[model samples]
Target: MENPAEVLRRVFGHEGFRGLQAGIVAHVMEGGSGLVLMPTGGGKSLCYQVPALCLPGLAVVVSPLIALMEDQVAALRQQGVAAAALHSDLDEEERFEIRRAMARGELRILYVSPERLVMDGTLDNLARREVSLFAIDEAHCVSQWGHHFRPEYRGLTVLAERFPLVPRLALTATADERTVDDIRRQLVLADAPVFRGGFDRPNIFITAEPRETERAQLRAFIKRASDGRGAGIIYCGSRRKTEDTAAWLKQDGHDAMAFHAGMEASAKREAHHRFARGDAVIMCATIAFGMGIDRPDVRWVAHTDLPKSPESWYQEIGRAGRDGLPAQALLLYGPGDIALGRHRIQESPASDEQKRIERGRLEAIVSIAESATCRRRALLRCFGEDLEEDCGACDACATPPKMWNGTVAAQKMLSAVLRTGQRFGLGHIIDVLRGRMTDKIAQHGHDQLPTFGVGKDLPDHTWRGVARQLVSRGALDVAVENHGELLPTDQARPILKGETQLMLRADTVSKASTPRESSAPERGEDPVFDALRQWRRDEARNQGVPAYVIFQDKTLAEIAYRKPRSLDGLAGVPGVGTSKLDKYGDAVLEVLLEAGA
Candidate 1:
C-alpha cells in the first residue's frame, strides 16, 4: 500500500498534514469511524481521500450536491487518481462507463448524492463490491435544526446499519455544539471519535456594515475587492435582488453573472461554467450558488443582507481564501433583517423548543454583527471556541469602528417603544421618535406624546442602529407574536434608568485596507505577477479549469516574487505540486524569463 504522506505529496501536492488532519487520516486508514469538523480549505477531503487511496477497495463519498461531487471528482482525476461521480446528471453511457470501471476494480473513489445512495438496490450493488469506506460530506446537513438541513441526509444512517464493517467518516466546515451533537446522533457514529480542527479561518478578514445604502456599499466593496483582478461572489437574500445586482454590475462595466435556483437548469450550468473558467468574474448570486463551487482565487465574499446564523455566515465566508491568500468577508445588514429573521423563526413549523433554540442562535448572530471588539474573536467564540487574543486581520482589529456613548439613544428607543404601547414594530417606533406626523401617528394620538420627535436629532438609520444594538445586547426584544413589535426586556431597565452605559458603532463598514494589504493591486503593478497571472489564466482556459485550480494566486505571487529561473527553482513554491510542476514548469520559466527581459 502507498503511504498516505506519499499520496499527499505526489497527488495533492502538499508537503505534509496540517493540525489534526494526520491523526484523522491515520484513524480512518486503521478502519476506525470518526467525525471531522475542519474549516474550509483545511484539507477535510484528505482525511478520507488519502485513506481511500491507501486502502484496497473503492471509497464511496456521499456528497450533498451534484455540482460539488463533479468538481471533486475532476480535481482528483487531475492528480492521476481514478475517481468518478455517479449522480443523476450522468447520461446512460456515462453511468455505464462508471459501472464498468467499478466492476473492473479500476476506480478508487466514487462520489454520490445522499438521495441516490439511499435508493433501492444502490447499497445492494455496493454490497457486491469490496467497499473500503464511506465519507459523508457536509454532514451538518443531517441536523434538522441546522440552517442548511437536508431531509435526504437523515436517511444516511443506513450506511452504518448496512455496512457496519466499513469505516464511515463525516465531515463539515460549520457546525455549532447543537449541530455537532445532532450530526453525531443522526449519523449514528456513536463510538467514532470527533476530530475538531477548530472554527477559525485567519485568511478571511471579516466585517459587517449596517444596511444603509446597501447597493452602493456592496458596489464599493466589490470594486475594492476585485479591482479588475480576481473573482468574487456577491450573495443576496433574494433571487430578484441577485438578478438586479448582476445586471447593475454588468452596467457598471464588470464581467458579472447572476446565479440562483430560479434560473433554468442550462442557465445555471452555463453560469457555473463561466465562473469556473472565466477570469475576474463577479458572480451575483443567492446563498444557493456557492456550496459546490471549487473556485480558489475568490478574493472576497459580500452579503447584501444578513445571514440567518453564525454557522451559515462562517460557511459562506469560508468559501473565500481557499488558497490561503488574503480575502475579505463584507456583510451588510440593516435593522429590517433582525425583525425578518425573528419573524422567520416564529413562522417556522418547528416545535416550541426548536424555536427557542433558533431564537438564541439568531440573537448570537446579531451579537457578532454588532460586536464592538475584534470580529474574528467574536465569531470564533460563537462556536464555543475562544481566541487567546484579538486577531489583527478583521476590520475591527485593523481599524476599529468609532463608537459613542449611546445611553441617551438607548433610553429614547426604550421610551418610544414603551410610550407607543410596545405593540408597534421598529418602523413605527422610528416614526414616532423622529416626529413623523403621519396619519397612523395622528390617528393613534402618538403625535401628542412627549417622546415624539425627541430623537429627531438623530438620523433614522442612526436610531435604527442604536435600536439594533439594544436588541442585540438584550435591552430590547422583538415580539414575534405581535407582528415583530419591539418590547423591552429586563436588561432594558438599566439603560432606561441610566444605570448602564451603551456604545454604538457610528459607521457600518470599517476603513479600507491600505494598498499594501489589500487584495487589489496597487496603482503600480508588479510586471512579473501580472505576467504569471496572465499565463495562468491562459493555461486554465486551455485546460477547461478554473484559473485557481491550475495555480492559485498565492502560488503565482510566490513565483513572481522569486522570479525562478529553472524548473527546480519553480518547484520550491508552496502550491506547485508535482503534477502542476511537471506540466507547467517550462511555461512558468518562460514567463519569468520574458518578463525579466
Candidate 2:
C-alpha cells in the first residue's frame, strides 16, 4: 500500500499535506473515526481522498449536492484515479456501470448523496462489499443549529450503525461551537477526535457599507475589484433581486448571469457551466449558487443584503480566493434587512430554544457588520476561535473608521423607546426624537413627552445609525412580535442611567463610503502570464472542463514567472503533478517558448 505522502505527490500533484490534513489522513488510514473543522479552500477533500487511495477497499463519500460529487469525480479522474459518483443526474447505463465497477473492486473512491446512500438496499449492498471508510462532506448540514440545515442529513447517522468498523470523517467549513457539538451528537460521532483548522482566511478582504443607493454601490464594487478581468458573485436575498441585479449589471456592460433555485435544472446547469468556464463573468445569485463551486480564481463576493448569520456570511465570503490569492468581500445592508431577519426568527416554527439560538446568531452577524474594531476578530470569535491581534486585511483594520462618544445619542434613543412604551418601530421613534409633527406622533401624544424633541438636533439618518448601533451592541432589541418595535434590553439600563459610555462609528452616521483597496499585494501584468492564461483557456474549452481543473492560475503564474523551459523544469512547478506534467508538459513548454520564456 502506498503511503499518504506518496499518494499526495504522485496522484494529487502536491508535495505535502497542509495544516491538520496529514494527521487527519493518518488517523483515518489507521481505522479511526473523527470530525474535521477546516475553513473553505483548506484542502478538506484531500484528507479523505488520500486515505481512500491508501486503504484496501472502496471509500464511500457522502456529499450533499450532485454538482459537488460530479466535480470531485471529474478532478480525481483527471489525476488517473478510478472515481465515480452515483447521482440522479446520471443515466441508467452509467449507474449500472458504476455498480459493476464497485462489485469488481475497480473503483477506489465512490461519491453518493446522503439521500441516495440511505435509500433502501443501498447500505445493504455496500455492506456486502469491502468498504474502507465513510466521509461526510458539509457535515454542518446535519445540525439544526447550522445555517443551512437539511433533514436528509439526519439519516446519515445510520452509517455508523451499518458500517461500524469503517472509519468515518465528518467535515465542514462553517460551524460554531454549538453547531459543532450538534453535528457530533446528530452524526453519532461523539467520541471521534475533533481536528480544527484555523477559521481565518486572511486572503479575503472584508468590508461592509450601509445600503445607500445599492445599485450604484454594487457597480462601483465590481468595477474596482474585478476591473473586467476577474470573476465575481453577488448574493441577493431574493430570486427576483438576482434576476434584476444580473440584468442591471449586464446593462452596464458586465458579463453577468442570474442564478437561483427557481431556474430550470438545465438552465442552472448551463449557468454553472458558464461560471465555471468564463474568466470574467459575474454571477448574481441567491445563496443557492455557491456551495458546490470549485472555481479557484474568483476575485470577489458581494452581498446585496445581510446574511442570516456570521457562519453563513463566512461560508459565502470564503468562496472567493480559494487559491490563496487576494480577493474582496463587500456587504451592503440596512435596518430593513435586520428587521426582516428578526421577524423571520419570530415567525419560525422552531421551539423556543432553537429560536433563541438563531436570534443570537442573527445578532452576532449584525454586530460584526456594525463593529468598530477588527471585523475578522469578531467573525472568528463566532466560531470560538480568537485572533490575538487585529487582522490587517479587513476594512476596519485597513482604514480605521472614526469613532465618537455616542452615549448621549444612545440615551436619547432609549429614552424615546421607553417613553413610547416600546410599541413602535424605528421610524416612529425617530419621528418623536426629531420632533417631526406626524399624525401618528400627534395621536400618540408623544409631543408632550420630555424626551420627544431632545434629539431634534440630529438628522433622521443619524438617529437611525445610532439606533442600529445600539441594537448591535445589545443595548436595544427589535420586538418583531410587536410589529418591529424597538425595546431596550438589560444592557440598556446602564446607558439610560448614565452609568455606561457608548462609542459609535462616526461613518455609520455619515454618508456611505466606498470599499478600500485590498491590502494584499497586487500582481503586475505579465505578458507570459497573460499568454499562458489564454492557452489554458483554449485548452480547457477544448477539453470541456473548468479552466482550473486543467491548470490553476497560481500554477500558470508561477510557471510564467519562473519561465520553465524544459519538461523537467515544468514538472518542478507546485501544481504540476506527474499526470499533468506527462499530459501537458510539451504543450506548456511550447507556449512558453512562443512567449519568449
Maximum-lDDT candidate: 2
Candidate lDDT scores, in order, read 0.83, 0.87
**Candidate 1 TM-score, true structure as reference:** 0.90
* Deviation in Å, model 2, residue 236 alpha carbon: 1.5
- Poorest 10 consecutive residues by lDDT, candidate 1: 514-523
Give TM per candidate. Answer: 0.90, 0.90
lDDT, model 2, position 93:
96
Candidate 2 stretches greater than 4 Å from native: 411-461, 473-501, 508-522
Query: Candidate 1's C-alpha lDDT?
Result: 0.83
Per-residue lDDT of 4 in model 1: 91
> Model 1 clash pairs?
none
